[model samples]
Target: MNCLKKTVLFTLLLLGISLSAQTVRKYSNEFMNIGVDAAAFGMANAVVASTSDVNAGYWNPAGLLKLEDNQISLMHAAYFANIASYDYAAFAMPLDKESVVAFSAIRFGVDDILNTTQLIDDQGNIDYNRISLFSTADYGFTFSYARALPLDGLNVGVNAKVIRRIIGDFASSWGFGLDAALQFETKSDWQFGVMARDITTTFNAWNINEEKFAEISGAVEGQNQELPETTEITLPKLQLGVAKKWVFHYDFSLLTEVDFNFRFAETNDVFSSSFASMTPAAGVEFGYIDLVFVRVGAGNFQNITQLDGSDSVGFQPNIGVGFKYKGIQVDYALTDIGDQSAALYSNVFSLKLDWSLFR
Candidate 1:
């Protein structure tokens, strides 16, 4: 390998080591999003089954192994009750007859908010009123490589990504992660595989102030405080999963999978910290005429305590469907949670488009 290739592999390893500590940030404000419906993620994101399409970038870069032509995908979604949104653009091509390389950019936007607080009005009079706006955004880059091997029955792939999160007018933090998988084919009628993801990441941070905020709220610090000296939080993120399939005589197949996510973060005042709990998800996929498909799934949630000792908690159920025409396919997903005190547990909805180079 040349220097450039060596650099790529070494950086991939660094992403895997990011699992050491936990984080104090609110991942829900960033990662907890659905662009193609909750059904996609609810099922272990196993879209790698037949990768000749584009959504594979988010689900399984290994799925790229199945692609024979270039392709692109665009996805977007409305998340939670916070008026947040997510957008993604992905494209890929072959680096060689046997290998493929893919690139993608994802964005999370927290629209300006109506800040409300009490003011003195310079008249020594206190009054509650709407204040300034608040919101945040982030960016992620992924470089994935995959190939098919003729080793009897072994087919595997890996992906690495650089993730950065930024808050409104705050210092941004950079993170890296790793994802790997192996798939085995038996009689071409049955396919089985396992995958691991987000093996390393901080998930969130504790603070974003341009400078360290004095803990005493009235303490003076030296010039060293010119730049934002923020507190970084950590999160343990490891996913282990297995999937299987049943193929019909025609081009149709029925697939199912289950995966477990273990969090290493400790329960704390931070939001995403509550997700320190474990999550086990399972679902099935169905295809007809190699063009249309549908899937449904469900899973548990991580519970975190909030003020008044009340926090959001529970099991999440989801469903999704897909349609293919010419070389274009569209996907949709939905996740539902019952209700809560402060706000009724909200539902998440997403849509995704996949186009192949052959088109």
Candidate 2:
């Protein structure tokens, strides 16, 4: 049909725009990178290799294959001293012995932002009633599928993501992206995983409401003469991880993991270059009788240049605890402890439930 052809052409044009190097940005759609599940956050996002729950839909979908039953997860956290809210929910189920599927959603937003642009009226009179409230938000919805490979220890997965961004009535955009992941387990009990995010370069075509923007265009002279860029491109990123577990006394266990995150462009990460940058993270979890857990992690390593032209390394540290009983789990994490990094400390809590819990 003619309509279908036009749609296809439009998609191709968007892809072409995303492929252009000049249009790409390093942190476009960064809300998705904030991560979900307090347990994973507590681990400094180093669970890519050992994740095996509903939240795996966001970390590494291939781990979904380890799901033994239908599961649901929910999390809520506030950032910047409660000025912003971040929430997540997910559901996962096994399709058969060797296949699984999951769906997840995330929302990050600042609500009730005062819109003071209309405070001064055309008559040079200030009207208190002109002030209104609006919200700026970003949302991501993902569908994931995973299946076992012919190789004994190999599994593969994929994710289809839909991103939505809103800045009150002034602007809005929608984006689409894809992710691929692999997980492998060795006979020695070591687990390895690799995740390719935004594999095809996500593109968002912004729709700016010129009429609404005109209200504040002249707030600053010479700065509002032109409209903002309409296209945003998110380049690809990669993550590699490995993990292992050890048991002691037949009732206590320890799990440790390390991950390396790679970005295509130069950055101030621990390892940086003109072509790429890498940030390494490590985490450990100690479990007592498979019911109580304690976790610690460190990540987000970056080199900061001080005013004296001296550079220093900074990282974030996190700690967490969890308890599970009757197919229900509760987790809490304190992230960015001691404020060693630029980010503020946050307390995150999450809940997980198995379908059997309700039966």
Candidate 3:
């Protein structure tokens, strides 16, 4: 392959390795793993079988086959006490009565972080006026297509994605991956779906400027600091979901979904992890026809070994509400990460438009 392609692949690999470390800098493209719309967020990401809107571009492409009209959606979230933000946009167009295609993008970042030097001036005092600012950002672009199979109520889809990561102006990496999905529905409105992400073990190659690192970490006397050439790889992940809908009155409905995510990587110990490396989630939604929605969910149900060598489990909950008027829709959600204390919360909002309603 060409030089540019090689660099991107290497960067993708780095993303996976970082995630495995579970540190603040663990994942290079961690933003791509975040759910898009409030619906998915509030549902604890149990959306593989429940996605029917533009958010399907990220959740399960096969769900796009449910859209009869052209649609577009935009969403934004204030993450981690407003220290960072995540944004998403998607558009889906029907290719025929049974097929559809979509394009989407996401950006997550922390901007304008102050950069300072440790050097002290006279009297051992540092100069505050010399500080600079830099930003760290991650981006993902996806092109997805879905089509109904000849078998009744069956659909298949795929996503081709490109990813990029940047830390200030000194280090940046690019990578790519592929995702595949399958969805099926029963005559009683029960749905099942499966998705495989980064099916090819996406790879990322890093190109670092050692000079920038030396500036950040002070230089040693008569010693040269050089960056090392490294490549990162991310293994594929599998997620499965099941959803069911119950109709009460003619105008009211309730939807429930359950999801399980499986990772192939090894963990620290058997006590802190499950046999299959699994994470389970469940969500419920109440709707008034197609005009209003309320949702609640809980997930990230895993055990962790605390610093004191004690095993503990925490609760993470999410809630959301939505409104639809004509062709326009609005949604809002609040997600709580209990493991990170009470203050660690994420707020998400989204808007969607359907072109067919106007015509």
Residue by residue across 136-205, what tens digits does model 3's lDDT show?
7788999999999999999999999987777675567777889999999999899999999989866666
- On lDDT, the leading prediction is 2
Off by over 4 Å in 3: 1-28, 118-125, 219-229, 268-276, 337-343, 357-359
Clashes per model (N, Cα, C within 3 A): 13, 0, 15
Q: Which stretches of candidate 1 lie over 4 Å from their true place?
A: 1-39, 42-53, 115-131, 149-153, 198-236, 249-252, 264-278, 301-313, 337-359
Model 1, span 1-359: residue lDDT tens: 23333333323322212321133432322352232233364353533443334455556566666676777767776554435567777777876767777887888766554322223445667665624454556677777777778775556677777767654443356766666766555665454555555555434343444232221121222322332323344333544556677779888988787766555554322224544645666778888986888887665554646779896665566667777777666777655534422222433344434344344
Candidate closer to the true structure by lDDT (higher is better), 2 or 3:
2
TM-score (C-alpha, index-matched) for candidate 2 = 0.93
lDDT (0-100) at residue 105 of candidate 1? Answer: 80
Q: Output the worst ten-in-a-row residue range by lDDT, candidate 1.
A: 212-221
For all candidates in order, the CA lDDT equals 0.54, 0.87, 0.77
Q: Model 2: per-residue lDDT, tens digit, 43-110?
A: 89899999989998899999999999999999999987777799999999999989999999999987
Between candidates 2 and 3, name the one with more favorable TM-score.
Answer: 2
* Candidate order (lDDT): 2, 3, 1
